[model samples]
Target: MLIGEVARHSGVSPRMLRHYDALGLVRPTGRTVGGYREYSAEDVRRIFHVESLRSLGLSLKQIGRALENPSFTPSALVGDLIRWTEDRLARERELLGRLRAIDASAPAGWQDVLRIVELMQGLNSASPARRLQTVLARPEGVSVPVGLLADAVLAESDPNVAGALRWALARSGGDGVAALAAGVHAEDVDIRRRAVLALAGMSEVPGVAAALADALGDPDPTVRGRAALALGRRGVTAAVPALVGMVVEGSSDVDAAEVLGTLSQDPGCAVRITTALVDELAAPAADSATRIRLTQALVELPVTSVLEVLRQLAHDDDPAVALVASAWVGVLDERSAEDRGDEDS
Candidate 1:
């Protein structure tokens, strides 16, 4: 076969085949009387082999080594090729993500596109301070892509950066809620914690409440506690059990008590919250310290039923608890007496 015929059959262009010959990747085995390059069967086979290697992303130099150097083992070269391919793939993926983020922003012009790209790059900076500064310095009234913020929020380990990201997401509202919600289900507990924290800041958004409801059952106590705190404040009765658990565990017990008090302001949930507190107090697992926290939580509830429970607890076995319950009940009793006397007068 001649050069043209070889090019036609092998799908390697004539120019590329000539370059291959020049590089000694493949050379014609003979020439005709006119001195045109001619390829024997072995030469054509070599051309196909070169094309095959090129298809696998081998450079011309690498192909030369592969074909001519007996010392060139496929193992090392293939390993190098694999690493190179992987790096290229990672770069492509990153570029694709940036393009998608830009598209999702629906940029109005080249300036908007550049701005979003810059913000994304800064958010992904290696330095935590840079990421936080990027979030804090976000342009006002210019739309920051919420998905980018959501991703930064989940991946951010620095507390300051995480808070700024959450603040940014809160202002951006519903745009990032979907991504934030997905982060809530991530296998990494830290990610789940970050997701819930971000959502907790944005719980006023339409779907965020529902997402938080799902996070109430998170396996991580920190994750569950944050979710429960957010949900309880929203007056979701489903959070009652977890909030009660927080009181017993003394993790943010004060805040949990305050939220429970707010929830109990509803006549409907008052009895339920009261019953939960009493049950924790009665549980054998409720150690002295646990019972003390639970007792303190009772002061936040204004319901009349808590008075009776406090009275019973006033004379309990733990003198410290008894003193706390008795003093608290006495204070409530005195306040009630004052009100009754004023009404009678």
Candidate 2:
């Protein structure tokens, strides 16, 4: 095939193909007298393999080395990559540790100052924005001192770094460490929201779980909804009863269907929770699309109770819900047959 044909088939641009050719990454199989490159099926396969390796975080140079060496073991290469990732994570943890120590100092009103320092450190990397994002992902309370330092870094860092820091902090689940939880219960809605999310990430922390459970009653539905998601994501079985209530009580402004769908995937969640989800699907006011989504989520659950619930939805008044439920029932029927066959053999 010609370059355009290869580009169309592979979803890689012709310019990138030429670059790869120049780097001896995926050379054309032949050339015309006039010099146009021609790629064979084998060459296309090689290009696909190169793309796959790149997706696995291999550098072009590293991939070239692996491809050139017939004896190269993919398992060894993956092990080496894992080691590299581990080392990088260790270094980031160390840097975060230093930032936390800085934040713990007795400096008066040093929140902004500490964040500025952390942001400055983040910008020193090749992808400053991405590095700053990594710093912000540190779980709350687990790294309270780190969160404070990130706050301090954000306060005085370069405007670009500060922006990245803010985005990261927004996603940070400030739950685990005591230092992070200090101001979490503040009267401010935004503060409570951020704190609740951070705490949610700290599900193992007793106080974090308490905070999320309490936030379920917040006047702001958005906060309550997010808290519901946080609890579900944490797989807090303790919160399943409350989440079931949220689904039925209808106080939650957030998509109760979606939250219930999430809870269905929790291995520790009870059959009663899933039963509540099925009941919601039966509601006349429920959107047909949401009902379909709930049915699909139920199908993914391993609990046998899901089979009965799906059967009930398979006859739902909404055609979409019935269709989705019917499809899942067929899949389950097929899986059950296979399991029986395996046992017999």
TM-score of each: 0.76, 0.46
Alpha-carbon local distance difference test for all models: 0.88, 0.66
Writing each residue's lDDT as its tens digit, candidate 1 over 1-345 gives 899998889888999888877877788989899999999999988887887898999888888887787777798878988999999999998888789889989988999999998998898899998888888877678787777778888889999988888887887769899998999999998899999988888857999889999998887889999999999889898999999998998889999999999999988798899999998899988799999999999989984869999999999999989999999998999998998999999
lDDT value for model 2: 0.66
Q: In candidate 1, how many Å is residue 326 off? A: 1.3
Evaluated with TM-score, which candidate comes out highest?
1
Give residue 235's lDDT in candidate 2 (0 to 100): 62
Which stretches in model 1 have alpha-carbon errors above 4 Å?
1-90
Show where candidate 2 strays beyond 4 Å: 1-147, 150-184, 202-206, 241-269
How much is the lDDT of residue 249 in candidate 1? 82
lDDT of 2 by residue, 114-200 (tens): 655554465455665666565656445433334553333323334565454444444444422454354345576665655554555
Error of 1 at 30 (Å): 14
Model 1 quality (TM-score):
0.76
lDDT over C-alpha atoms for residue 110 of model 2: 68
